[model samples]
Target: MESFSLLLRGFSVALLPWNLLWAFVGVVLGTVVGILPGIGPALTVALLLPVTYDLEPVSAFIMFAGIYSGAMYGGSTTSILMNTPGESGSMITALEGHEMARAGRASAALATAAIGSFVAGTIGTVGLTLAAPLLARVALTFGPAEYFALMVLGFSTISAVLGETPIRGLVSLFFGLALGLVGIDLQTGEARFTLGLPQLLDGIDVVVVVVGLFAVGETLHVVSRPHHASFITKVRGWTWMTRADWSRSWKPWLRGTVLGFPVGALPTGGVVIPTFLSYWLERRLSKNPEEFGRGAIEGVAGPEAANNAAAAGVLVPLLTLGLPTSATAAILLAAFQQYNLQPGPLLFVTNPSLVWGLIASLYIGNLALLLLNLPLAPLWARLLEIPQPLLYGGILVFATVGTYSLNSSVFDVGLMSVIGVVGYFMRRFDVPVAPAIIGMILGPLAEQQFRRALAISQGEMSVFLTRPLSATVLALAVLVLVIPSLLRLLRARAAHQGRP
Candidate 1:
């Protein structure tokens, strides 16, 4: 009941005239970016970070929330029509959605994708509304030791899950940790990795790193690759779903929401996992499983719902624990820091309006996406027609201008270009950049908590193990790091024993 009242208050804030306009603008921009190949929400939000510096925090975050959810909605259009996933989360959608499009059911495929996204996004938002506060309350009990342990869990889970191999993920994470170590030591008042540059004293800005890696690096990558001709499936026939289509889709929407929210809330959960799980689950539950590869509406419905729901789920830990599970969540964390606000239990108490208002905007955003996407998916699909050179040229200009605007530092622009080159190499090598981003953001916090824990224990190393919660969380982190290697070893041994 208290949550309900607070939500009503949130709605009051979100419905403000200015806030509504920002929400509209954000969703519109997000949909545009999401339709264009290679420009996801992370890059869009990163580019806008500098632009939002003077904006009100509540308004900025509301716009960001709209962009986040709207991108999820828009990615489906690209997946269904062009067979190109605008975001990794939408990759699963391409399998059946493109197939449906090919078979001349483009309208049905798009309709189910849009409607399922609406259902799942709404349900997931409700879950976030109910769950985040509870999680925040629980997190309020944590000590420095517990916080450190929790961050370690985040580090391990992200490093283990993101790349093809855990080694590659850890490599990416270590790179970020190295960057985090560049700034002056807060406690010791000493520079570690400054290399005698004055700008190194304050460290590289998160915004610069984000723009370099996502915008500049992605642009360079796309420019380097040969452009391939893509076939766009035209929307034909009635755009509305038939009665049979509705029956096949509703259950999958509910199930995808059920699977997405909890997984997304977990430290290890991400959109890719839940989306793939939803696809697999839908296949198993389908009465006509064979239709899965051949344009089944269930295939389009389930994964699209899971993709959006999981996007919402990623916000839960981000809000409650200040833990980011995905690259976009990490960037959002940077936005919070730009305003000198920290996400976690205290954020809710200190900034209830911001917290609740942000949540409420999500509801509005989801509704806006449904209404906007259904009627205008064809128009959104036309975005694919944009010339690559023009699109990438604009991104480079925005990225350069955004980086330069941060302190008007010509040096920062150079730094961004250098990092952009590094980012290009990281992508070329298939090293997941998300771990690097998460690491850079969380590394300093982890170090702070670790030192605090030691101080509380009078330099005792056992503090992390002495506290029950800390011990459990640390043990879980270890498992996250170790389990995959153990499983691989077991598989190798089994293969050896079975000797071909």
Candidate 2:
């Protein structure tokens, strides 16, 4: 009942005229960026940060919520039509969505993906509305030791879960930690890795890093590859899903929501794992398993739903614990910092209206995406016709301008180019970019907590293990790191025995 009342109040705030207009603008812009390959929601939001500098925090966040949801919807359009995914989360959708398009069932594929995203997004928002506050309330009991342990869990799981191997992920994470150390030490106010540069005192900006890696690096990668013209299938039939399509899609949608939100709400949740899990589960349960690689509507529906749901789930940590589990979430955390607003237990108490209104806008954003995509998908498909050279050139322009505008510094732009080069090499070597971003964002906070916990314990090393919550969380982190390697060894041994 309390949640219901707060939500109703949130609706009142979101329905304000200016806020509604911002939401519309954000969703439209997000859809456009998501349709263009190599541009994604994080980069889009980072680019728009300069434009939103004057807007009120509530309106700005409402707009960001729309962009976040809209991008997820628009990404599927590219995946289905052109076998290009605007976001990594949409890769699973392309596996079967493009196949459906090739089979002339493009209309059904698009419809199921859009509708499933809407369903999963709505459900995930509800979970957010109910779950975030409860988690925030529970988090009030945590001490510095517990918080440090929790960060350890996040660091361990994020490194292990992403990339081709844990070593690659760890390398990326350590690199980020090293980068995070470049600024002055917060406690002593002493410079650590300034390298005699004035700009290093405040630390490298997250926005600059995001644009460099996502926009510049991705453009370079696309330009390096041989350009192949994409073939888009024309929509030949009704845009609406048929009864048969609905029957096959509904179950996967439900199952995907169930699988996605919980995993995503975790402190270290990333969209990739839940989406893959949802896809594999759907394939295993499917009555016609052979249709998986061929044009299976269930495959497209399930993974798309899981993708959006996980996107929503990322907010759980960001809002309740000030923890960012994904690249976009890390960028959003930077946005919050721009306003000097920390999102955690205090955010709800200090700004309940902003918190609830953002949540309410998510609901509205999901609906707006569905309505916008369903009628205009044919037009959105035309975006694929854009010339690669022109598209990449525009991305470079935005990346440069966004970085320069941060402090009106040309040096920031140069720094961004250097990071872009590093990002390109990271991509070439199959290193996951997300872990580095996460590590850079979380490393300083982890360091602060570690020092605070030690101080509270009078420099006793056992403080971390002496606390029940801290010990348990650290143990869980160790298990997360160890379990995967043990499982791999066991599987290898079993395979060897079977072969003999």
Candidate 3:
């Protein structure tokens, strides 16, 4: 009840006419940047930091919250329609969503994405409001051992995304892990794979990889195969979700929210793991698992929900413990510092208005994003109506510009083209690119956490087994890897016996 009362007070502060206006402006700007490739909420917020020097802290934070939530919603647009993800969190969405667009189900994909985002965002905000303090404490309990174990659990999900055969997926995953190792070693300061290039010391940007694989590679593949039919399909009408679609999507949205929030609240967690896990879970629970790569609505719905919910979950630690789990959270922490305000438990007491107001604005921003994006889903899907030559020409230009904007480096653009060619060959060989992306992201983090744990325990390998949480998670990871193989073997044995 006390929490309820405080939230009402927050609503009072957030509902001010000026505050509402700022919120609207922030969401609008966020949506635009999110639709464009390469520009994510972190960069957007960082760019706005200098301009908001004179603004009131509460108003500025309210606007920031709006941008954060709005960007999560907007990213799914490009992922669904163009096969390009505006943010890393939306990358999984492009896999199935673009396929749906190819099959003339773009409107349905957009609708489910938009609605799932809203449901998950709103529920996640409620989690933020009521359980932030409790969840933050839980996040604090995760040591390096536990975090490493968690990464192992994430690694186990690679089986779900591995397409066609395990061998192909392992090849792609190993490639990604190799790419992830290209930068300088953090602890020793030794350059591992820079190849004497000054630019490579900082490591390859994930945005460059994503854009290269999806947009540039796709454009090249299509251009090379001019005799094949056009990829885009014509829309029959602006049909939203049918009754069947609603039944299929709602459960995934809820399950995704369940999976997304707790993981996101962890200091070590980010949007990637939850979204991937959600996709895996949906595929496992799905009635028609084969439809996953071919545009399953549950595939679009679950990961999108997890993506937005994880976005909200990132705030729990930022608000309650002053921990920045994700890049956007880190930038928001900078925003807090710039205002001579610190985020922690005391901030909730000393500046209840700002804290609560920001939370309240998330609720407002979610509703605003839903209203803004829902009506435009059909219009956005119509991007496919353009001639194929013109559409892909624009994608190439857009991909190049977006990749270049990361560091303003011409070399990065060249690197992206190289990766794009590599992506084309992966597609040609029917290798699953998702495992590569997963490995590229998680491999480095897992290595870091593993080293940290060993250093803390004086190089004792038993630390992971000694801790109950770590041991439990490691066991789960083992099960994730072993269970499917066991099941497959049993079925094969049964078939052989019956045939004899």
Give the number of the best model, judged by TM-score. Answer: 1
Per-residue lDDT over 1-500 for candidate 1, one digit per residue giving the tens place of the 0 to 100 score: 78888999999999999999999889998888778887889888988999999999999999999999888878888999989898888999999999999998888898899999999999999999999999999999989999999999999999899888888899999999988888899899998899999988998888788888888788788777888877888777655788999999999999998998888889886788888999999999999999988999998899889888888999999999999999889989999999999999999899999999999999999899989988888778788888777888888888889889887999989999988898999898889888999899888888999999999999999999989999999999999889999999999999999998
Residue 418 accuracy (lDDT) in model 3: 93
Sliding window of 10 residues with minimal summed lDDT for model 1: 232-241
Please give each candidate's TM-score: 0.98, 0.97, 0.64
Per-candidate alpha-carbon RMSD to the true structure: 1.2, 1.4, 7.2
Cα lDDT tens digits, model 3, 104-141, are 88889988999999999999999988887565456567
Off by over 4 Å in 3: 1-117, 128-133, 158-170, 224-362
The collision pairs in model 1 are none
Candidate with top lDDT is 1
What lDDT would each prediction earn against the true structure?
A: 0.90, 0.88, 0.80
TM-score, model 2 to reference: 0.97
Clashing pairs in 2: none
Comparing 2 and 3 on TM-score, the stronger one: 2
lDDT (tens digit, per residue) of candidate 2 on 1-500: 78788988899999999999999988998888888888988888888787788889999999998888888988999998888787888999999999999988898999999999999999999999999989989988888899889888988888898878887888888888888888889999999888999998889888878888888778777777787877777777665788999999999998999899999999869888888999999999999999999989999999999988998999998998888888888778878878889888889889989999999999999999999988888888888888878988888998888999889999899889888888888888989888888888788888999999999899998999989999999999999888888999999999999995
